[model samples]
Target: MTHHLAPAPLLALTLPSEDVLYAALLARDPAFDGRAYVGVTSTGIFCRLTCPARKPLRANCRFFSSPADCLAAGFRACLRCHPLAPEAAADPCIAALTSALEADPARRWREADVAGLGFDPSTVRRSFRRQFGMTFLEMARQRRLREGMATLAAGGRVIEAQFDAGFDSPAAFRAAFARLLGAAPAEMKGALLQADWIDTPIGPMIAVADKRSLHLLEFADRKALPAELARLRKMAGGIGLGRPQPIDQMADELGAFFAGTSARFDTPLALHGSAFTRAVWEILRQIPPGTTRSYGDIARDMGCPEAARAVARANGANQIALVIPCHRVIGADGALTGYGGGLWRKQRLIELERGYALRHDRQPDDIGQRADGGEAGQP
Candidate 1:
């Protein structure tokens, strides 16, 4: 079996300016929890942004991007935040429970089931609530709703969908359908796309797809992801969160890519964009793995050399991450440019591909070539 090695951990040595990270720490923003760690010089401990402890003064707070960085700087993990613990999605216990839920979304989960899995009910409840903003039971309910919706979307009869969703009676299923979806099962419109979350080496990603093609694949931390989802929902008529066939295929391909066993993506994609944007994305897919092309090069290939900026805009608008290979686009000078997933991730991806190319005796792209015609290696 090919093991998917995790992405390089975030480290303070490569983080943004101290002032920027300090501000995020002051806000206690949950979005920055795994992306950064706050080290308090006075206490010699580092904590996640979501830590419940009182915030230290700006002068006393030093920021690191990973627990390893904090340890390297002679700081211990804060007991309050348990900074050394794996992220919620990566936690072995949480991962096991989530897998089980995916396998049987309609199964009624109980406190006894949690204990039977060798976990305390209260502890599991708190973990689920904190990580997902809902109890495990609530998540199961939503999963059932999505599964039922998927069945309906696939043209199954109302009775079939209700039973398939594990509902005991049509009345119970109809009540839930109306309460959550604002419509009765018979009156509801079929969803054009289904959404689901997949855990990756970098982070958890949200995948949205129709029956035939993948529509979106983006890191969950992207600031613009919500807006992208809203746009997709409008275009697709309705988008529900659940496992779809395309999502499972994408998860497998992603696992293979991260494991360095393969870079090819066979999952079909639904390109929703202007003609020019679609054309640009198609060119992106043509660029082989371990190789890159600049915006100018893409524009030239499209017979519009002056449209480089427009091409760059289309590249940025790409919703699909690794599969579409937008990270393969670089500056004219061979430097990495703006990436919504963060520059650190862009850098890491380039390095990962370059290493793979070297190991396989493939000719790597020109990312290492400086404007002055010298090798600069990884950016």
Candidate 2:
């Protein structure tokens, strides 16, 4: 049988060729699980390759490989079959624990404490670090620091902010903030800076945007953020560091979003990524908040279906989270796959959209605080 190597143009994004699709399927890689799909255009229905549903003939079945592809081809998401949800959960225990930690960043979490939560300390430690690139305890500490920053921005006294943030002492809080943001609490005041706090279902997110665009969006204490901001400072010639205002406009819109009142992200964005990664990020923005597509679908839409793995890699490289709408992309089986913001966040984001009539794009740099700190896991 001749294998079709070209991607079907009906999808929103590109996808891999038939040979590559079959290989990914045969290998049962959970990574590519939701990025591809097979459509029996003859039957006017599409199904995930991993779908337990009966398999159709390879010839009669046209492979669209992405939810957008299937939709573009005039096929609707199967009501009896959902292909947007990922089949396999990526490290479920770690995901749950991370969600718990984010929810309660004020609570001190020790390895022994985590062990008492019915998870193996070593496994939990390795899983969180591998998935998020930071230890659970480290994430907690960062969260406390972010809370301190937010509190200070809200006009609270240093001591009040420090204690409320769960800091052991004023000195410790100041040191931690200085180490991470290069400014002491008192030094962070003044200037045209404005600050505000917004809460998502997962946790609180902080956004700093100027009048024209958003500069940073992040959870309260995400680990990657302090470093990212340092980079932004160098890029902007040290303009919006400890001082705010540059990111004020974005903060308002972000607040509306998490409040379940709005989903439109009109703020201009500064995305830092390679050309291919940039393209993927752009497509991610086009995905509506409530809707979803797969990475394979994105690849096909980009006219490079055979580059599904490469597309997935680019998705992983995406920095801005919800604003870019990367979370809307699911595995082939309609399951949540990789999300740097954590699957729990992804799930809650979906739920929030649904509850509020669901509308949803790329988060700007440092888009929100992590509530807890560290690298966002893969998208």
Best candidate (score: lDDT): 1
Candidate 1 structure quality by residue, lDDT tens digits, 1-379: 1112122221212455677676667676554555567878877777876676667778887776556678999988766556765456434557788889878778978778878999877878887765555677766776776667778767788888898788888999999876654447665445778766677865568788878889999875566776887787677677764677999999998887787767767888887889888888877776555565778878888878999999999999999898888987776643456778765466456645654554444433321211101110000
Single out the weakest 10-residue window by summed lDDT for candidate 2. 370-379
Task: Please give the range of 10 consecutive residues that has the lowest summed lDDT in model 1.
Answer: 370-379
Residue pairs clashing in model 1 are none
**Model 2 TM-score, all chains together:** 0.55
Q: Which stretches of candidate 1 lie over 4 Å from their true place?
A: 1-16, 86-104, 107-138, 146-160, 169-251, 257-264, 275-379
| Each prediction's whole-model lDDT (CA) | 0.69, 0.60
Error of 1 at 286 (Å): 11
lDDT of 2 by residue, 106-131 (tens): 88778888878788888777766654
Those runs of model 2 whose alpha carbons end farther than 4 Å from true positions after fitting are: 1-11, 14-30, 36-92, 95-103, 169-171, 194-197, 202-204, 211-213, 219-224, 231-262, 267-379
Error of model 2, residue 324, in angstroms: 5.2
Quality of model 2 by C-alpha lDDT: 0.60
